[model samples]
Target: MKNLLNSVVGHQAVIDRLTSLVTTNRLPNTLILSGAKSIGKYKTALGLGQNIFCKSKVGASACGVCGSCLRVKNEQHESLQILKSNDGLIKVDQAREVTHFLSKQNNVGEYKVVIIDGAEYMNSQSANALLKTLEEPPENCFIILVSSSLYKLLPTIRSRAQIFRFGSLTTGQLKQIKPVDDWLIELSGANLEIMEKLQDSSNQEIYMKLASSVSQLSESNYDACVKQITSFTKNKQHSLVLIQALQSLIHASYKKSLGMSMQKIDWQEPALERLSALTQSQIMELFTESVKFEYYQKSNFDILLIFESLFLKLISYFNGEAHHASMDRYSYTP
Candidate 1:
């Protein structure tokens, strides 16, 4: 089936806004779609781009059977160019190439659309190189900058684009679009994009390992948590995955303590029930710590040391051994 405008889940308001822009022919040349990772910004941008280029649009929607729409759907459209980092960061040369492409005319479609996925991956040099193009974009050409990290984007580049923030999908929305794995939905906190990745059977095992690690923490088995982290996670990215799993566990527990409904994960619910003894403030504190842990991971700090310290802190909290004194002294800085 074609991934048309309606194929994208949730974000009805974003869809509505895009419909208005397209119908009124007021679509901006530079647009920044921002939101949490795997929350559908990139998909929405791609779908919208197709709809804009489709020769036969049906009242703000694209006619999927049309040749133009089919080509765009299959990523064979000559007028559509997508730029994304292949090696972790969008290099300056990529930006320069996109700038050159945008300066030219539309090849086959009515609009030339350029999608820069992970726009935040643009380093200082790349961002600066793209600034001029954003400032004076070519006619009938639209540039979409998709990013989960809004703060990382250069302010000058952000200022030149019309920004749209895509929010997380609600439980109801998640159920409608992706319902095969409800537990994954709960664990992801309705981040359907991430849930989609977790849908792979292989990923489920990693999540189980992570859940086991959290369960170990509740039992005050600090060594088990460390071993699990080391065993399943090989590097900083892997450590971040473990951290996300832990964050999900903590968040689920927090919701449970508040009498909020949550889908029960067989592996995680046991520890979450035990962790109910944790106060709201303590849960919030750990949530904050997870944020810092992510920052430290991104900063290229020592991976083993970071996970070890985090597991140790989790042990302290679960054992009622954590204190303000220790919280103040805890540092993951390299």
Candidate 2:
């Protein structure tokens, strides 16, 4: 029905399946949609809600001119209930609200609809409450659960629902993105356009300062790791992303030290030489620990202190010939 349903961008496969589900009258009362943030998973659920609420049922198709359609579009439908996540948690009371709403007779529509956003936030009690409802779903009821983290849900609760996986966006599909400074990738929780977004701002000053200090960390030359990471994460706070980028540089340094790769970023030579004195595993351990430390910094344990301590570690790792600085004393957990 041209009625209450709204269109969503990307994921044609998901759209096609949903359309089929509605058209065939085989719609599942419990729908678990998992995907990234800012993506259209919740939007899709809303679309499904509209279709279910549409009054006209011609071979399972919704007619937009029906009273139900109008009510759904205006969000005045008595049988429709929407539950949102609060403080990253969707409580049991909200789920119970759905049950209560659905139990009532439809004043203007044939069925009841519930849209649960961030269903992953449902705590143990909340999920158990939902399990009660899902186990004995009332006739003519539709429940759509949207979540970013599916594994975080209870296995019994998850098993009761039909799972619909929403995949990531394609590069070409990125055109639909609103022109934000940095695009948060819904599935991965990383910023894809962070560096591009940062290229136009005064934020370069942070990188410049970071770059200057990068050299202070090493003896052979701090350029390799320092230049790559600063140049990369300078624009983004993506945790796994920066770690992955840093991993590439570390591998390159290892290759350079073994004289396997002829092409090296000029700044890495001193680092390669100094690191050559250490075993590959030691270097790996150091890099791995630093990656965890970076994640901790990003997750809000204290960014400045982490950065300063990390800076000191880098200096120590690079201090092949340069006299060791007393930067260790400066390290403190903030």
Candidate 3:
């Protein structure tokens, strides 16, 4: 626990609360680990899980060197179950699968732990089904619901759990982190996804390239936009990384709209304005569709057609011709 706290910068209060919960024998049955996505909620939950199952530190803390701790650390623990996602949602059947393992007493452990990384995406049926288990969870089971937006979850499901909000790095604290420029650039874009990955130094070059691509994308050059994004696609190993980059762009633009500072970086005003005009919800709708376009590229969707659609959408928004653009009622409605 001390190691986890010391590793993640800032969020001291959250660390304290989690440490208190684990070390004091006051852990909640259903914990809502609420915070922005990629802000360490899942990682924290896993840390808590490790501490829970660590055999050496038997009483209330984890002994980092124990066999149990090693297993959990390597994600080989039998009792530790993580439901990644199913059918674009954590559906009822998936939740049912959890019940199967949860039904059995921990085979060789004291506790059975489950962490739902994106609980908000659990559809209504699955959520309600999970609520039953949460309402009367097994004696030694721990349920951690990690959410980026708790509001997207049902109040009934929420009421069944103890909601703990995740804390973010203040600008001052973030400025102190290593690779300050890179981290700040990500935070400025309000992208939790890339921020976490940036901590992994190996991805630094790719992260910076993606940042440059996002900053440089505009309608002035459709071919350039395609080349940049396509190049980004070629370079990125995971499709989710690209989506996360776009998500960060959305967040940073929103914060910029609210006048948040980027600390010492000389953030170009025109660049931000151009980014805002190009994305900012109006462009987000199109950009989001672009992901599906990228996804379908493997199965009949033309890459040019997809990027072209995005180019036109960005041009309309950039030229203040969005009102005249033929967007669906739902596209720019929000």
- In TM-score terms, candidate 1 sits at 0.83
Assess each prediction's global lDDT (C-alpha) against the native.
0.78, 0.63, 0.66
Model 1: per-residue lDDT, tens digit, 1-334? 4546677778889888987898898999999999987667877887877788777777677777887878777777888888988788999999999988888866554578999999999999999998988998878899999999898899998899999988877777768766656777778777765687577765666677866776667445667666766854566556667667777777888899899877877787767866776789988987887778777777776766766666666666767775535654445655
Give the clashing pairs for model 3. 189-252
Model 1, residue 180: what's the lDDT? 58
- lDDT tens digits, residue span 101-215, model 3: 7888655547899988799889998887787799999988999999988998999989999999977766555555534565445544544455657566545544444456545
Per-residue lDDT for 116-225 in model 2, tens only?
88888889988887787898888888888888889988999889899998887764455465443222222112333443433544434343333334534553444543
Identify the runs in model 3 with alpha carbons over 4 angstroms from their true place. 1-6, 58-61, 106-109, 171-187, 194-334
Alpha carbon deviation, residue 25, candidate 2 (Å):
2.2
What lDDT is reached at residue 322 by model 1?
58
The C-alpha TM-scores of every prediction are 0.83, 0.63, 0.60
